[model samples]
Target: MPTSASAFEIQSDFDAIDFAGGMIAEAKRRTGDNAAIEYACADMFDWLARFPEAYDCILTVGTLHHVDLTSALRAMSRALKPGGRLLVLDLVRRPGWRYVLINSIVWDAPASFVDGVNQIS
Candidate 1:
């Protein structure tokens, strides 16, 4: 498995996702030589751009919310090899005025701001 991120510190945010330093080390220890694990601390888009269609699978968890959905998805698609799979686990918001307002405030944007939801499907 190959993992990419902007940082690998075992801190609050990273720890919550189980991708922090300690977790990665523990996983590596458990897997031993049977698994080939690679980690890179680089911008996802830049990394994907440099290695077009290089990966068999790309897994993203709780990350798209913070990025430009269209751009990120496009990059991920380009980075995927033929018959590749992209598994994304993310939070979904219900469609409504209240939810929109909440998302705007939580994300620090306008009430009409849409992030990736409209772009999908």
Candidate 2:
């Protein structure tokens, strides 16, 4: 369930679906309320399935590094209609023993070893 669709699009155009809460809110606040401004506080995966063929270009940036990337992406792919475009930008890292060690050290950075405080806290 991999997807190329995104909420944070790189390009702004007529085909772009601005799937962002912060942007939507900022627009309303700055522009003094425009009626054409459409916004939703919804999950991306759930939203895609609801409107399969409504969009053409999709963009997702820097999300896979946070949560269950596989499950989220799979659902997004299914949501897309045929020929729809998707773009995914994430901090891709090699999965290995070395990766695990480096992440353990830097994820709780400024201290190489945190006296197991990283594990406990």
lDDT of 1 by residue, 1-121 (tens): 4366636634321111232567556655776754235654456777778878776666676666666666776787776676666666666475644334334422422112223334556
RMSD of 1: 12.8
Question: Mind giving the per-residue lDDT tens digits that candidate 2 earns over 58-80?
Answer: 55555545545445545555544
lDDT value for candidate 2?
Answer: 0.49
lDDT of candidate 2 at residue 55, scale 0 to 100:
52
RMSD of 2: 14.3
Listed in order, each prediction's TM-score against the native is 0.51, 0.46
Evaluate all candidate structures by whole-model CA lDDT and list the values in order: 0.56, 0.49
Off by over 4 Å in 2: 1-23, 27-37, 92-121
Q: In model 2, where is the ten-residue run with the lowest total lDDT?
A: 108-117
Residue 39 of model 1, lDDT score: 50
Q: Candidate 1 overall Cα lDDT vs. reference?
A: 0.56
